[model samples]
Target: SELHEKVKLHYNNFKGDPKDVKEMKERIEIEDE
Candidate 1:
């Protein structure tokens, strides 16, 4: 339950923080390359 709730909380935060989401996406892309 804690893991599920944490995931939900993070999802909401990601929506609220566009800059964070963008940076996370960029980091993901960089790691992929």
Candidate 2:
């Protein structure tokens, strides 16, 4: 959970692009599976 939060924060700081965020989330989901 901490890692996820940190990643989200990092991403938010660098690229606050919704599309990229969504894509990253999707990639994370796939990795999780």
Residue 27 displacement in candidate 2 (angstroms): 0.0
The digit string of per-residue lDDT tens for model 2 on 1-33 reads 677777666666766578888888776666545
Q: What is the TM-score (0 to 1) of candidate 2? A: 0.54
Q: Relative to the true structure, how large is the alpha-carbon lDDT of every model?
A: 0.61, 0.70
Judging by lDDT against the true structure, name the best candidate. 2
Pairs of residues at least 3 apart in sequence or in different chains that clash in candidate 2:
none
lDDT against true structure, model 2: 0.70
Query: Across residues 1-33, which tens digit of lDDT does each residue of candidate 1 receive?
Result: 565556545655676468877776666556545
TM-score of each: 0.52, 0.54
Instruction: Quote the lDDT for 7 in model 1.
Output: 52
User: Which number leads on TM-score?
Assistant: 2
Query: Every model's Cα RMSD, please?
Result: 6.0, 3.0
